[model samples]
Target: MKQFWDFGMEQAKSCIFPVVIFLSLAITKVIHLSLIARYDLILIICLVTQVLMVVTKRETWDEVKVICVFHLIGLALELYKTHMGSWAYPEEAWTKISGVPLYSGFMYASVASYMCQAWRRFDITLGNWPSTWVVCALSAGIYFNFYTDHFIYDFRWVLKVATLIIFHRTVVYFTVNDRTYKMPVALSFVLIGFFIWVAENIATFFSAWQYPNQEQGWHLVGIGKMSSWLLLVIVSFMIVATLKHVKGKMKQAPKLKTEKTSF
Candidate 1:
């Protein structure tokens, strides 16, 4: 049906950046290049794709900026995680900083790119959105928890509960074939997190990065990562929402009197 085809097209459009990155990783594995060389190729591919997205008008300048910001944020986390022995790049690369590859940042950037494209392509909008300050506070807490969990208790469950409460009434509206559809904001976050977990498995299978266990050989990434991904999705969502100016309602200032007030 036309509706089905339209839905598929919208989804594909949103996924274009992620698909390209994964395919590049696959090709890198097949070619059996050196670790540094593979990372170099991936970095080049990501840069080219970003340029092309802008040149082709597939992404606006603002969207590109948001994606770049995601890269920085992701790279910061990568540096800390790699340093803490959370995971590692098994090969050497000139672009590496403390065992983390520069290309690794693009992996996070791809998520932001997908979100930006999906928002525009699907005509997505948010309703009953939670206060931006509340979301930001939760996001910051979740991010810090990633680093603090080793030294202290992880309140991931508490954060998750708070996330649900904040987003419980929020709805995401999108269009397919000119017909609008709606879904719960929390459900969408969980779904995206699930898919990102699946992709993480595939990325690890290709040896993009290795866990402590995967140092010997490939294996499935732990299911527990889904919770982390869920938190990250919220972070990414907040960034995109801020950029797109879809944070609940925008209040217009009241009009002033046309004539000047008497002294």
Candidate 2:
């Protein structure tokens, strides 16, 4: 019971960024602001929340870099996806480009923020990690498929199979408190994806954005979206993993140089 309580607490702590985003969504939905658009207001709130996190020492500058990279990646995807009519942001806002609000990218950044925080708070490490080349190729493929699928064949299933094969042996080790726990990397992806899917429903409920079918009335997002989220979570994980790996190597370089000089 104690361990479960501690684990829940840590998970909540890791979710602070996402919680702030969601709260902004809900609050802006209820409050009417004529001078400032809701979408722009949400963007401001997200920016302020990020700055506060950094100022409070909750997130490091290095992690902020990772989040910024995700913000760009997500914004690009949003531009393409909105152009393709995957979804629509109905509200007008100054921060919108091509009908997509800039705040939308922060939605993706929140995911990266959660992963970064969880990695630190839970003392996470990967076992039997794949080679860098394989991981990079897979991540690239997963990302491009989102765009290419609109024209060519959808290879999500194939990518899912590839992901399973590539990560079958990999395990994520995380500490809850004093005891360490382990889970399959693939399973973790699915779990995170599921929760994100739930968050999606909440976001849409507050009119964050709407699918074509959802423009009429609110309904549950399709279960199929969970698979999309699962693939996305994998991409997010790979980005975070790559950054951490690079930082680890950078730290080791100084030690190696000193050792070589001494020898």
Alpha carbon lDDT at 69, candidate 1: 95
lDDT of 1 at 138: 82
Per-candidate TM-scores read 0.91, 0.94
lDDT of 1 by residue, 102-221 (tens): 999999999999998888887787777777788778888988888899899988999899888888987777766656667778889999999999999999998889999998789888
Residue pairs with colliding backbones in model 2 are none
**Which residue pairs clash within candidate 1?**
none
lDDT of 2 by residue, 198-239 (tens): 999999999999999998899999999999999999999999
lDDT of 1 at 4: 71
Model 1 is weakest, by summed lDDT over 10 consecutive residues, at: 254-263
> How far does residue 1 in candidate 2 sit from its true spot (Å)?
1.0
